[model samples]
Target: METAELEPQVLANRLGVEFYLVRQNNTIGCVITIAALEAHFWLESRASDARILKTFRNGYGRICAIAERKWLARPAATRLELTPADFARR
Candidate 1:
């Protein structure tokens, strides 16, 4: 899973979300857009596929927390809020 070689859409589909690639100066990173149980938020990473996946596995709580806060700030009626528990079951 060499993320640099895969298309953004492919990675987004695999992760069940939308992704955007951001390039600033000489740096490249990813912003993942996630729709949960009534809310949507983003996660970003400049790491490789393996590292990002590892974070998804081990740091989901932090991700969920970030999403939740973002969701709370801008509540939406059409999206869902997802927790780390939801991701664990996926």
Candidate 2:
């Protein structure tokens, strides 16, 4: 897929999540947050790279799985305070 065809915010809206653009060390990436689980997943992709769309798609699937199996397993209150690192250790 082409980068131009992949709009992060559009995907997030389709998934009913929040999307943010982040920059670190001169690199730009997308951070997707699932409000229901308070879970955040980051996907690093260059806007100029055509492969970014594929990367975004894969990351989106991973985040969905993590949110469902890991975050959703906990109580809603616990999920509200959970972080991405918490899922990684599980």
Candidate 3:
């Protein structure tokens, strides 16, 4: 499935933000930490949820691509977390 085709429902938590990517009728949980956002995407530290969502939206394409690659690597995994290294690799 193409993660870019779907607009994920984003949620904020104590650690960071979480979203889902659908693949073959399955929902794969994905998370990107606030620290990753700040370090890689220029998100402000302690950003508001709205701001965080905006950052995610701004970087949606790249983020989704990475998530897609990860999902393809581990299809059986129900959840995935994006780290600074993931962003840094590209």
For all predictions, the C-alpha RMSD in Å is 13.3, 12.9, 4.1
Tens-digit per-residue lDDT, 1-90, candidate 3: 465634454453546677788767788779887788888899988777788889988998888899999899998897999989888854
Candidate 3 at residue 12, lDDT? 35
Best by TM-score: 3
For candidate 3, the per-residue lDDT at 34 reads: 75
> Candidate 1 residues 1-90, lDDT tens each?
355543333253444332222223222223343333113222344444554555444544555455554455655423433343444433
Off by over 4 Å in 2: 1-54, 75-90
Whole-structure CA lDDT of model 3: 0.80
lDDT of each: 0.40, 0.38, 0.80
Sort by TM-score, best first: what order?
A: 3, 1, 2
TM-score of each: 0.33, 0.31, 0.81
Native-referenced Cα lDDT, model 1:
0.40
By summed lDDT, which 10 consecutive residues of candidate 1 come out lowest?
18-27
Give the better candidate number (1 or 2) by TM-score.
1
Clash count (model 2, backbone only): 0
